[model samples]
Target: MRLGALGTSSIAWRRTLPTAVRVPEVDLVALAGRSADKAERFAAHFGCAAESGFDALLERPDVEAVYISLPTALHHEWAAKAIRAGKHVLVEKPVGVDAREARELCALAEEHDVVLRENFMFLHHPQHSFVRDLLEKGRLGTLSSFHAAFCIPPLPADDIRYASDMGGGALLDVGVYPLRAAGLLLGPGVRVAGATLRTRATDGLDLSGQALLVSPSGVLAHIAFGFEHAYASTYTLWGDRARVTVDRAFTPPPAYEPVVLLEEQGHQERFTLPAADQLGACLASFAAAVRAGGTDSAREGADLRHDTVAAMELVEAVRREAVRVTVDQ
Candidate 1:
């Protein structure tokens, strides 16, 4: 499938565009930007043409799909427009700021008969499969709970994630990763048991937060995320007989061999998983879906759409449960 890029975001220039060009199933044809000069620079880097704007890229006959790496706030609007323009969409994570917006885009995709997928590329990683296999093999006895952490140091003052109008917050940014990790380890039907969101006095945007979630079958997950901390992206699952922990769970470099440790009693076992390019996997998978006429069953597009809404449901619950912190006057 011929694919076009819809933004010049860091993830797009650094990962998505680079990987998309390498995926055999995708022909990196065009890149769109608000400015012609910026688009031209990005397109040149990928050996593709530049379109002055998203509309121009959508109108191009060579572009069959769009990879949207725009801000969180613009995801719904641009994704909807691309779907309506008869192009498949691979949007960045948190397809929308809320469940309702995600549902609307899902419905629009169904109505337009196009595929719409959120690029939570970590889901495509093989390490996750290894973790699942351990669970399925009963290496980890009856599951009890899991804890995940995805924190990173603060960004520059002008970073888009701090922009309230642009749908910026710790809960929507890094928080979604741990939430998705919980669903992957526990189950999809996890519900937020409690949450707390905190913001800096200088800015009201949520800077850090944590959520307690429980799966339908009683599995528990503690998820925490923030933008002002030491870099950490890892999760651990505790079971009756054994516990499994994965380091570099999210944002592992493509060639990095991830470490997984399993502890039973006082004995520990370690495994080094093979290198996997999850971003490339995501591009290939989405390209296959587009080539297959966006069939719902060909890929888990339907379930993914459902999960988008489910994820936001937990996010909303967290927001409602957030306790505002203040200092005595």
Candidate 2:
């Protein structure tokens, strides 16, 4: 299966995809970017085929899928096109800028009878399951609360992360991971009780954050994210019996070694998450589903659509309590 990668200012895929995609079964055939000169350099640098235009690459008879790692704003446009072209699509998180777009994209993918996977790579990792098993086994005991935080300082004054037009915000960029962890670990269908957003140097974008989501079971997950704050990154599930803590839950080093502190019986059991590139695993699964005709005969597509819409619902819910900390906005 030949795959085309679209719009990466940084070569994240160059390092990660090789591990996730089976080289024998999948080939990185083409790449597309906004810069022709940069595209040439990226192709030469990554050994990608000369077909650099995104549209042209999608038209390739052998190109079976398109992995879209572009900015949040560009995802819907390209992903929709890929689906219409009768090819499977893997879209990065925050699948759409809003609920309406997400809903439409999901419907379009179904109409075309193509695979549409939101690339929430963490969902595919075995480490998550390993921890989840402990949770189910009552190791963590009765679940209580979840607290997750992800923060990274702005790269530059003009970095895309600070740009509002690109659907940029601490909540959308970093918070989503923790928020997803909260929703997933605590079980889905979250209702936001409150949210507090801190504005950055740039107006309208959250530089720091606080969002509270409550599950039907009354479990609460608190997410703290920032584009200008500490390097703290961790996901913790607290329970009546004990708590399980995982450090570097998201964007972990390529090695995929996650550590956890399991407290029970008056002891702290330190465990290491296995070595793996979950992003690759996610891609592989989507590919497998495509190869098998599908995992749910378009029912999987419906689930993807549901997830996209659900994510947007949370984002909009959080935005209500966003506080302006700067004069710019």
Candidate 3:
């Protein structure tokens, strides 16, 4: 249960993740960052003293697990290193900016027989499963298509999400959500057919991007993400017999309780359950996987490969689509 944390900035370990996840009771052994003062402050806040820079923390004997909340660019490198250090890793989304890197990390983890879990806490959240249940149960019969959008206004200029060298973009950041939702609900093998990307003037990252995911089952998954416009976190599944939708699917999930809504034949149903504290739950799951001798779910080995490959493939596809439009014009 000893956990090492990298990049304590973005998610604000003190703010976003539950105290149950970061507290010393969970074996919060070390905090690593580029700044000594920041690390010290974080350690003081969490009531731990074994703090150091990233490389130094990796050298510690007590840190058996690592949670990486670093910028997108750093995730692959650090996660790979953590795996090499014989630590189970829980990495934030995208896993890598590309599939090859993701595959490499996965291989490295397997080479060591260490658990590697993607911190897609949203999927771990209950709402996603609840909605998927409705779809699987024929509540959305003869599924026609899926549509989702996740967007937020751009942050200040200092935001790492705007750094191209760090693999920042709407596609890498917010875009993955709707795409992940599609894969979860419609099955993997989601790919981009066509798309448009419009970037903000600040860093030329995708301020707004729209794309279509062609499901192999002949279903269309239309998805969008952006760094501007109103904030939205929602998904809709359109079917001949009914429709399913979810609100606030990605974040600040008040526990595992997922809110699910179903509409069929002019009748509607809404469901909400108390959420499991996912941050705590995810931490517990990783620790249990470690003690139990392997990854907790079958999805880790092969599903992770297919899922991340599909995600990266679509990211490239969308980027290429944007390029194609410029070339054609």
Q: Which candidate's TM-score is highest?
A: 1
TM-score quality measure for candidate 1: 0.96
Ranking by lDDT: 1, 3, 2
Candidate 1, residue 133: Cα displacement in angstroms equals 1.1
| Candidate 2 structure quality by residue, lDDT tens digits, 118-180 | 878777777778889998898877787988888886568777767888977778888878777
- For every candidate in turn, the CA RMSD to the true structure comes to 1.8, 2.3, 3.1
Tens digits of per-residue lDDT for model 3 on 1-329? Answer: 77788877657465433453454346777788767888787777776654658888888998888888888888898998888888888788879888778778877877888888777767767667777787788877798899999999767877888788888877898998888888888896777888898865645667678898788898988888987758998889999988888887777545445667888896988887676655566666667777777543455555765676677777778888863222110
TM-score of each: 0.96, 0.91, 0.91
Residue 183 alpha-carbon offset, candidate 3, angstroms: 0.8
The stretch of ten residues in a row with the least summed lDDT in candidate 3 is: 320-329
lDDT of 1 by residue, 1-329 (tens): 88989989988888888888887888999998866788889998899998878898899988888999889999999999999899999999989899889889998998888888989989999999999999999999899899999999988988999888899988898999999888777877889888877786765788888889899889888888998789999999999999999989989999999989999998999999899998888888888788777754434777877787888888888888777663221
Candidate 2 regions exceeding 4 Å error are 11-23, 294-301, 327-329
Against the reference, the lDDT scores of all candidates come to: 0.88, 0.76, 0.76
True lDDT of residue 15, candidate 1: 85
lDDT (Cα) of model 1: 0.88
In candidate 1, how many Å is residue 58 off?
Answer: 1.0
